[model samples]
Target: MSKVVMYVSGFCPYCAMAEKLLRARGVAEIEKIRIDLQPEQRAEMMQRTGQRTVPQIYIGQTHVGGYDDLSKLDRQGELAKLLEDL
Candidate 1:
């Protein structure tokens, strides 16, 4: 499996849901970067994605966007191929 990295806050439901979906898809060992815990990470996330969203996801080096974007990719059958490439 490829690496799953997510920038999330502690109180985001969308982040939790995204994580659950990834886990369900057999993505173990998710590397979570808590924006709330480290203020610098928030800036990093924003710099990377140009968005201050709570759930900024990255599957390997691919920027998977937020929770809804991630789910959309999965529903559209693009996620598996992306992961396979990763």
Candidate 2:
């Protein structure tokens, strides 16, 4: 499976949902960067993703985006392919 990284906060439902979806698709480990604990990382996330959101998700090198974008990819039947591309 691909390496999964996510910029998230403790209280974000979307982040939790994204994790659940990823796990459902067979992702074993997620490298979670908690921005609530590290405020400076939030700036880095925005710079890299251009989105000020709780769940800035990346599958390998592809920016899979937030929960909505991730789910859209799942609905389009690309999530599994993305996750397994590594």
Candidate 3:
């Protein structure tokens, strides 16, 4: 499986939902960077993704944005293809 990275904060419902969706998609491991614990990581996430929201997700090196974006990809049937090479 591809590497899944998510920049998240504590008590984020979107982050939890994102994790559950990814897990259901056969993602065994998710590298969760808790920006709430390390404030500097929030800046890193914004710089990387150009967003200030929690649950910024990446599948492999491809930025998948947030949980909504991930779900959109899944609905479009592109998510499985993205994971195929992993």
Using lDDT as the measure, which candidate wins? Answer: 2
Could you report the Cα RMSD, in angstroms, for every candidate shown? 1.8, 1.7, 1.7
State the lDDT of candidate 2 residue by residue for 1-86, as single tens digits: 33999999999999999999999888889999999999999999999999998799999999988999999999999998887786
In model 2, the number of clashes is: 0
Evaluated against the true structure, the overall lDDT of model 1 is 0.89
- Is candidate 1 or 2 superior in TM-score? 2
TM-score for model 3? 0.95
User: Which is the better candidate, 1 or 3, if ranked by TM-score?
Assistant: 3
Least well predicted 10-residue stretch by lDDT in candidate 3:
1-10
Better of 1 and 2 by lDDT: 2
Alpha carbon lDDT at 32, candidate 2:
96
* lDDT of residue 4 for candidate 1: 86
Error of 3 at 68 (Å): 0.4
* Sort by TM-score, top down from the best: 2, 3, 1
TM-score of each: 0.93, 0.95, 0.95
Model 2 pairs whose backbones collide? none
Q: Please write out the lDDT profile of model 1 over residues 1-86, one tens digit for every residue.
A: 23889999999999999999888887878889999999999998899999988799899888999999989999999888877775
Error of 3 at 22 (Å): 0.6
Candidate 3, 10-38: lDDT as tens digits:
99999999999988988898999999999
Clashes of each: 0, 0, 0
In candidate 3, how many Å is residue 5 off?
A: 0.2
